[model samples]
Target: MPQMSPLSWLILFMVFTLSYLGFLTMNYFSTFYSSKTPSQININSTSHSWKW
Candidate 1:
């Protein structure tokens, strides 16, 4: 097994932190723009009863 050096660990941590921050920022903006209308509809059909 290979072990990462201190500098490598630091760099990996920074990259992960930045990526997480970017994801959070995107989610924040999405939430902000997610609700503009008041009405929503969802339809689900689970039965097949048709007359021919």
Candidate 2:
């Protein structure tokens, strides 16, 4: 097998790290919001944090 250089290892690590960050960012920040009534909205705002 061919040996990999330090630069190649660093580049691979960076690529994986950035991809993981991007994945988490999109997963957490992106949400599905359907049309909700005013009462439902008020209840959600007043209640404690529970995304699920």
State the displacement of the C-alpha of residue 30, model 1, in Å, after optimal TM-score superposition. 1.2
Cα miss at 26, model 2 (Å)? 0.3
On lDDT, the leading prediction is 2
lDDT per prediction? Answer: 0.80, 0.84
Query: Which residue pairs clash in candidate 1?
Result: none
The C-alpha stretches of model 2 lying farther than 4 A from their native spots are 1-4, 32-52
Query: Candidate 2, 32: how far from true, in Å?
Result: 4.6
RMSD of each: 6.5, 9.6
lDDT (tens digit, per residue) of candidate 1 on 1-52: 2475877889999999999999999998787455544346445658999999
How far does residue 20 in candidate 1 sit from its true spot (Å)?
Answer: 0.4
TM-score of 2: 0.52
**CA lDDT, candidate 1, residue 14:** 100
For candidate 2, the per-residue lDDT at 49 reads 78
